[model samples]
Target: MHVVAIYNNKGGEGKSTVTVGIAEFLAANRNKKVLVVDLDAQASSSCALLGRQSLNAAIREGRTVVDLAAQLKQTRRPSIDPEQFLVWRAASEARGSALESMAMLVPDGDRMYDVESSMVWGKHNHLFRDWLKPKLTEFDFVLIDLPANVTKSAMVCVNGLAMSDFVLIPTRSTHISLNGLPRTFSLIDQVRNVNGDGFPTVLGFLLNATDKRNQQYRSIVRPMVAASTDGEIPPFFQNHWPASPALEAATDEDRDARTLKERFGNAYDHARKVARELEVACEKYERTQVQPIKLSLWQRLGLA
Candidate 1:
């Protein structure tokens, strides 16, 4: 499986929207089995995929990333079966049958704070990644929606980054939002430096909530953003998501059923195009990137 983390240190950049939209498109259109892991304590992606009611029920039952993270902390313990927390066919059945292959590991908003406070970064660093690598071989993609502002959830973000094979940044086109890109890259660099081989690489930037008429973005920030990447990967995705009420509304998780097209409304094409770009990135990363040798906990900790 090709694991991906949809992340940005800045908030309100539409990371969760991109995560859910791309996951649905990949599962429904590309015929890929997708697993969405909601690492954010906010659980926005989980609620979007499973609806608030189901997500709440799962949270009540202690079936969430918090539970998984807590369990994985005990290295001596047997692996917890992924199915225990995985919600199969997570999207609304009313949406379409195409999302049958989509699933999610919901999050707990209530207990995540306490969980993160207790976490020792080293002990939990690669625990989740190693536990998942062998058991989730059947999945085609694992899309992780990481919490914004790395400082707030460092442990969870580190683990998410270490688990992912690629990181897709979704950023708003505004100057403040664009300014956060460097920090995101800096954190990724730190993860790569410490984690060593197999650390996630930058997939590219997916501009979200863009204004087509904004000359500032078209003339200044856009090229500046592209140049910042130094042509490492495709600096910016060819397809971007524009700001639209319809697209924002799609994040709502109601009992009402809606097809993918109906859900995205006028933004259907945008979502599909973004998803296609993501698929291409995944294929390229898998084909050209070197596979990392599995390392023991002590090795990763520099204790061996």
Candidate 2:
């Protein structure tokens, strides 16, 4: 399975929206089996994918990421019964397209926010890699919608990023969002530099809530992103998500749309177009492997 993380340091940058859109496009249009991992304590993606009522039901029924994490913490062992957390008929689970596919692992921000972080992040930070990497072999694609803050609620999501084959950075054209990219890039570098370990390739930036008429996006943001196309930094996607109520409303469940076209309305075309481009980018990333990190102090000391 191709594991992709839709991530950004700052919130309200359309991370969840982009995640659900691409996930739906892949599952509904491309016939790919998908699993959406909601890694936020707020559980926004969960509500978006399954609706608030359904998410509450899942939480009450002990079928959330909190329950799964609790299972491991109580036993003092790391394990993953993905089924326990898997939500059936998620946003991507198009009707009659696939079997019990396109499931979601809803987060428990209330219970798991600071609750699980302090307990699980021991010396070994491979909380997700240790378990999730193996179980992920079951799907065609695993997409993680990570929370905005890393340390507060979900450091485990870092391991998710660590195990990902591709990292999808969804950003707005604003300076606030663009300013945070340096730190994000630094974090990715630090992780990848560990004993020359393999890391996910940035699958290019997906511009969200863009206005074609804006000179900032057309002249400044677009040019900056194009210039960022070094070997390590990813280029921007050709298609962008337009700012529209229809696109935002698509995040709301019970839209009752049968296909990607019906759901995203006018933006459906660009959404599908971006999804196809992402598929190709991931394929290219798979072919071009990341270079190993040079030995660190630990590796030199025979510790790593």
Candidate 3:
């Protein structure tokens, strides 16, 4: 299975929304088995998918990622297998698909699973890598929705990236958000260094919540496109995910009665385009081939 992390250092950059959108697209349209691990304490992704408030609620009242790890380390007791901890639920029945048909495994419980700051590192440092070795053939992808900032949860995100084949960085086309790219990239570098694996290559930097009419967006897009041409960053720049009222509306209410494909036609169309780009990136990465140049570094750096 290919693993992908939807990450960015800044919050409200549409990271969680993009992550859930992609998971839904893959599961509902591609008919692939998906596992979404919500490592954030906020449980936004978990709520979007399973309607669970937190990860702890799914693990029964007595267990947590930390509790299991401590038990395993302190008492030499075998902790709960990661697979058993999965909460299985159907995707929205509005699409006429069973929960089992979409996600093969999800976090199980009612409260939310919160990753404490202390438990973020080394809970299963190499455990995910080892655990995924045998089960890699079971699914098409394992998508993780990381917390917004570089905290302990972010470190767990890096661990997920270590095991993943590609990483997608979602950002807005603005001075403040774009300015923080270096730090986010640095975090990825640190994760790769710690794991002794090369940095997790970006699938692409997705420009989200963009307004076509804005002069600022055009200004930003021009330079970013130039950078892709110059090879300052990987050339897997996907299509922009336009800002839409439908996205917010879908997020606010349960439209599960309608297939995501049917409820928001325009939004799903954009998501499908993004998914197509992702497939190409995944294919090239899997084969260890270089991505073709599409834009210049000047454009990528937003200096064009």
Candidate 4:
């Protein structure tokens, strides 16, 4: 299975939207068996796959990503039984496209017990990897939607990245969000150093919610793109997701392809293009056996 983590340190950078969109594209278009793990506390990705109202009620009952992970770890497998931590979202269609849904699979009866022991003694606290190993062959892709900021919840994402083949960083053209990229990169490097192998490659940095009309967008993004080629920064996604009001509206109505095409215009086309690029990157990284570069303490502190 190919694990892909869609992450960004800054919120409102369209991380969840891009994560869901890519998973939907892969599942419906490429006929790939995709599993989307919602690691965000807000459960936006879960809500998007399920429904806002249904997720709202789930949250009210304190059902969240943490609970789900804990339960799975405790059982040392995907939970098979339904509980507060497990929710099976019925697959729904929008614009003739089917949304990817999740079924909670608890492997054993000791859902809580296994997770606790793993945290205390397992290597790298990677209980998620141990739980997912048995089921990975069942899917072509596993997409994880991470929390906005680097926190304990975010570490789970890093653990996921350690198993992933690629990592996609989604961000807007704003300075603050863009500035967070280095730190995110540092975290990925840390995971790579710890794992010693199977570290996810930086597939590409995706520019989301970009405004073509804004002069600042060009000014900032142009330099960033140049920096990538100049070796000052890593390469980014060639296809950018421009701001589209229609996308938000379509998502609200749960309209799939037709709505996405109408709202996003050429954005989806670009997304596919970028996804292809990511595939190429993954192949190259695997073939070359590239190792992640470590950063100094000052570099990680964002002061370098």
lDDT leaderboard ranking: 1, 2, 3, 4
Instruction: Kindly list the per-residue Cα lDDT of model 4 for residues 52-79, writing each as its tens digit.
Output: 6666666566455455556555563464
Give the distance in Å from residue 230's predicted Cα in candidate 3 to where it truly belongs.
Answer: 1.8
TM-score per candidate: 0.87, 0.84, 0.79, 0.74
Worst 10 residues of 4 by lDDT: 104-113
Which regions in candidate 2 have their CA more than 4 angstroms from the true location?
A: 73-79, 90-101, 120-122, 194-196, 230-232, 287-304
Enumerate residue pairs that collide in model 2: 41-109, 196-293
lDDT winner among the candidates? 1
The most accurate candidate by TM-score is 1
| Tens digit per residue, CA lDDT, model 3, 169-231 | 888888777776666666666566556656466777888887757998777665665665666
Model 2 residue 235 lDDT score: 75
Residue 164 miss distance in model 3 (angstroms): 2.1
lDDT of each: 0.76, 0.71, 0.61, 0.60
Candidate 3: segments with Cα more than 4 A from true spot = 53-80, 91-100, 104-124, 152-155, 253-258, 262-265, 287-304
Clashes of 2: 2
Q: How many residue pairs collide in each prediction?
A: 0, 2, 34, 14
